[model samples]
Target: MRKLKIGYIPMFRGTARGDREILERISKELTDLSRTMDFDLKIGSEIVFGYDTAVKAVAEMNSFDPDFTFLGSYGATIGSAMIPMDKLKGLIGLWAVPEWELTGRLPLNAFCGSMINAGMLAKFHTEKHIPFKWFYGYTDDPLFIDRFKVTFQALKAIVALQESRIGLIGPVVDGFDYMLVRESSIYDLYGATVDRHHSVEEVIKRAKDQSEAAVKDELAAILAEGSKTCMVDDEAMNRFARLSLALSDLARDNGLNAISMSCWTNIEFNYGNAPCSAISRLNNKGIIAGCEADIDGAIGMIISRAMADADAATMCDLVSVDRADDSLNIWHCGPAAGCLANKCGVKWDHHFDMGHYEGDEWHGYGVVADLTFKPGDITLSRISTEAKELTAFGATMFDKESYQGCSGWIKDYRMGGKPMTLAELLSVIYNNRVDHHMSFAYGNFESSLIEFANWKGISVAKNTGYVDHMELGTLGK
Candidate 1:
């Protein structure tokens, strides 16, 4: 179980009727939930002191370094000083339901609306460049608990994967912010580091130092393996092969495990056009590399690599990712053996740049492992911003046999679950919410993911298979 750093503030909890006594009652209730759920509750009240609870809350919020922070009832209504908002990883607001007795003396909805204020906190998070989620409702509600636990666990995995370092060489295409996640959020939450990001000039400078003989030697092995080598012609192949050598050497020297490189420079440098076929070769080394130098998609490669380390899984773009459970079709152009564990005929795993359309240098090499768990429970995961961190965790998968990617059924198949399927899990991941993500690991890790979730204060849940919307659609008609 991962030890959770949960944020909570003391001071006041309920309406100011024997305030300390009311707070004590609420604390006891929260304690009960913690004990029952086996969560490590890090309360703000214990850390925050004196006349202002808001100041105390923010202080506690920073100190606890929580995966998620639960703003107790009163803390919301009478906020003291402002929280940096950047400091928080994620947010959860607890609203005490209004009973006749509880509301008669205090404005129930007004305070509940304050719980809504946490949404504003999320807004502030957005503007201030913080990644967070505003989770609200009665803490004891089973629905809330169920979703909350699952979310926290998933959030943890997302953040952890983000903390991962993906070396970016050269430039990415324009207007591609999705590939570049916020640097601060990852650093704050998951200890994610970007390491060294280089440009084409750097690669060229490195390439110049390498002897042509060494470059030729590397290309010899690559050429021997690729039939595409003959089809691509020599002019294009020479430049890419040299680039591949430089990249491999740089990766080894810098201790980089993964990379995303832009292949357009060959044309820009007047060296003829070459797809980033080099990325395919890197993928064979089990080092993930993306074409177009897209960093956003590189995170997916990160997810796949992490999954491969733990389970029988693969990483792929949503295009090749089929939502149907029976067969999640993952394919790559270069490596025949990259997607399969055991294969025949020379058993060669090679890389080549796909995404080519007749004459373009933007092609990429992709590697996909079949990321479906058949028969029993399998966890799906990705590293995304969670409570301002890059966390990773398991997610629900659709049934094994009923899936296929032939049609656009990925989205269709994803629509019907209670955040249990791959689609449902990703549906709510938004600006204020966490990223849509999952980590599918083999076996029933409900216990482990949840145990680690609670210990780390991450969200956790049992994996329910995908919902069958077609059946529901038929019923609706």
Candidate 2:
């Protein structure tokens, strides 16, 4: 289940029962849903418009940094309210303008009466193409509310780990550390402290060995999936099982919530099954796991939030950067689950040829993953360290069926408001002031992101000349 943070607005427009009572009644529903739904709710106490409501609901959303927003009879001028929150997706306007006493039926006046508040939101965001959704007319409709609550709950559950601690097992591929603007970048942008352990061997050994029962169960799972049951000796399978279990346990033990390891030599030195499969399983379990100990996968972990699930992170790589389109491609290496696709019943695992790693002369294996960024909002971000820049670019979720592979692309992007050629895209990455590595978050979590940065007291956002708005908006003509 997804753990989404939600922002709620309380309404009492000309109600016989004061605003406090009105909010109290709504609070009951919010509380009940929090218990039953996956959504995490926070009441934005700011006024939501300008300044001066006794409650100040707008400031509340800003402070809470909610993933989904609940407009509780709030004023639309509160676009500033939108300014301080997180990714801010899935907007639900709640106008419970009290249709009491003389009412025998519809609360038309109660909801319909908030014309000014609603109009501004539509006008402001529509022009910006912010993609805000609306759900009005709440009554004793438990079923409908329940269903809506599920979706919003999922929305709230979407967490990109604003201050997350991703464990880096050993060093990255020689020069690739520059390609991964992880730890320090997190510290600078999100106050996230990455605790890098000095041992990759330990993690590898753990994954290379697991419990006897888990090994059997895993083998059975693969068997159930129709994988060629015996690719090697039974002993090796048991060893691989033990190692996998150990790796999981170690991550938990060290508080290394998410682990990325350099899986070549260490994996081959002990076991046979490519760490790829095991990593895939862990990712699906909500623990950010990436093969080859790559930081690019960290970007994938953040983007997974857009999937509306803890285990929805896609393991991918930075493929081609298309400057003309102002976009980038994140490619995967295995068969992904069906949930990420707009379709259903898709296979998320498959047999494949393993790359040359450790002492393995030549061995092949199976891997699984949902195609990268399919049917979900694509948020491609990079944290270049050379000059230290945290840049963000994105587009809508674009896909229908679940294709089984890692060879897909996001197309048509532009920089300087002009179509960019592939070469130009490369030049941008090379010449642009970035730390070499990047961070990715599905959809856009800039709101919560901002909070994280502020919380860290890192001046990345507040610093002038930080984001090259000129470059992003093509302002120079």
lDDT of 1 by residue, 305-417 (tens): 44233422333333234434523332233211123222211112112433344466433322112112233334433343433223233433333332211111122122123
- Candidate 1 residue 443 Cα shift, in angstroms, is 13
| Candidate 2 wrong stretches, greater than 4 Å | 1-164, 180-193, 207-211, 229-240, 264-266, 269-273, 318-330, 335-405, 409-477
State the TM-score for model 2. 0.53
Q: Count residue pairs with overlapping backbones in model 2.
A: 57
lDDT of each: 0.46, 0.49
Per-model TM-score versus the true fold: 0.47, 0.53
Model 2 gets an lDDT of: 0.49
lDDT of 2 by residue, 1-477 (tens): 246667776543333344455566677777777777656788655444432442355554556666666666521233343333223344454453435544564432444535544555556455544333444544346533744544442243234444356777766766555555556665564434566774766765565456566778876664443233333445544544455576668768877657777665455444444555556556555666655666645644553454333445555555555455444565555523233444432233433444444485443443333343445544444433323444444444454222334434554433322444444445455445433334443453443333222232322311122233345322222
For candidate 2, which ten residues in a row score worst on lDDT? 458-467
